[model samples]
Target chain A: MPAPAPIDPRGPRFNQAVLSVALLTGFLVDWRPVVPLFALVLLAGAALGPKYGPFLVFYAKVIRPRLAPPAEMEDPRPPRFAAAVGVVFLTAGALAFAAGHAGLGWALALMVAALAGLSAATGICVGCEIYLVLARRRPVAG
Target chain B: MFMARGVIVIVILFAIALAGRLYRAWRARLQDEKPIHPLVPDSLRAGADRTWVVFTSPYCATCGPVEASLRASDPGARVVKVDATREPHLAESFSIRSAPTVLLADVEGNVTARLVGAQAVDDYVRRPPSGVAG
Candidate 1:
């Protein structure tokens, strides 16, 4: 199998910033649709690659051109895997909201928001780090 | 009232995040060189001119890259990675609380330099060790 293409390191951070803001807004306004919608976007990104990610596409088109190219690029797989994990949290949170568990829904949603904010601000993607560690644990194919 | 609850969640999470950041910072702060523990196995340093003992954890993003860099920087040095999560006693012997905590030791097994993060590891690697000419 071919290796996945590398990506600009900033692309994931840009997506994280947008995701954090959207999640906070959704929580504050008690919007039921936002979490699931964002979850779908993340799912698409994880399954179909960066071209399918709305914010990543936006970054590539609008933001990336304005800035100087990054000094280093990074493996796209880890961040994409992180997006897949985010989908699980978001889906659970949305389910909680639908089932009238407001507190639980907010708790899960807020955790994702906080993590996304941390990644956006500091480039510390805990979910991505988890992905790398798990990858290391996997047995190599002969 | 619902908006207030949302705000409360945000505030609580914010406080927790701040506490975590401060704790990691405290843990990663610089310290004076210390002696290697006798209990640490002799085999870890047996064959290297300079042995780099790295304490790592499963979830540390920087650990892999730091190990790679350390290996590439010196042909003579050997890196010994200890999984801190699995070997808590070894981690405790050195007071390690952060991942990628690196100890640079000489042939005599005395730790000459201790580094806590990737940036410090890079800086240390860039310079020749204390006795070697740059």
Candidate 2:
């Protein structure tokens, strides 16, 4: 029989990029109260990171026993996903900061990074599911 | 190690960093807003009109060319994109296992074309054949 898919341990700390980009975006768009927000992002990514594995331990905890796992239980996502997240971080952060919003862009980027890390740690890809639900409704969500 | 200790060299490096940052600040521009994610989904075909969906991820570099040409050629065509990594459900509905997958269909709700990987839109537009749904 084919072996069950292994939950790959590591992926790019795309969240770090998200935090940085978020800060950059805020800077480019609006530069008020920048240091604190940007600093928060940097700290979060550095602290709770894309370590050798997730902080939550999906395989041992979420998956093995069976706890309402979603359809994508078989494959946790490719390592390439980290790169894509980075692109989103870089672009969105740059745009938001450049748009003259508050340093909210920095906060937003860090938030995404934290959520992303949380999801990965928990074996739940928030972005993937967000796409799924949105796609279900909108034509372009796909 | 002694070669790196020169103060003038460090000064020049910092100046270049500052210059690069300023350049980007001045030149930053946005592309025409285009969805760059899950390109296709089963539900995207739900509408009465025939549809063509492209499943793409930012990692797949070539999807941009295809999306641009398609929009320029026929603005009315339904070309949806869902970031695959971010939207695994959309990808799942269409059985998307890879990046840059393309799906096409007619008004009847049957898929006509399902192409995986980056495809040159010119080749599709020029020859413009019925896809998997027809």
Give the Cα RMSD of candidate 1. Answer: 4.9
Q: What TM-score would chain A of each candidate receive against the reference chain A?
A: 0.94, 0.37
lDDT of 1 at A123: 73
Give stretches of model 1 more than 4 Å off: A1-11, A47-51, A60-82, A97-107, A118-142, B1-17, B20-40, B54-73, B79-92, B95-99
Work out how many backbone clashes candidate 1 has. 0
Residues B1-134 of candidate 1 have per-residue lDDT tens digits of 77696766578458657856875575455354444554335678885667889998655556777899888887678789987767777778887866789987777777777887777888887985577521
Local distance difference test, each candidate: 0.77, 0.48
- Model 2 / residue A118 / CA error / Å: 33
Assess every candidate by TM-score: 0.66, 0.32
On the 0 to 100 scale, the lDDT of residue A76 in model 1 is 78
Off by over 4 Å in 2: A1-142, B1-48, B130-134
In Å, residue A71's CA in model 2 sits off its true spot by 34
Span of 10 residues, lowest total lDDT, candidate 2 chain B: B27-36
How far is each candidate from the true structure, as Cα RMSD in Å?
4.9, 18.2
Model 1: pairs clashing at backbone N, Cα or C within 3 Å: none
A79 Cα displacement, candidate 2 (Å) = 11
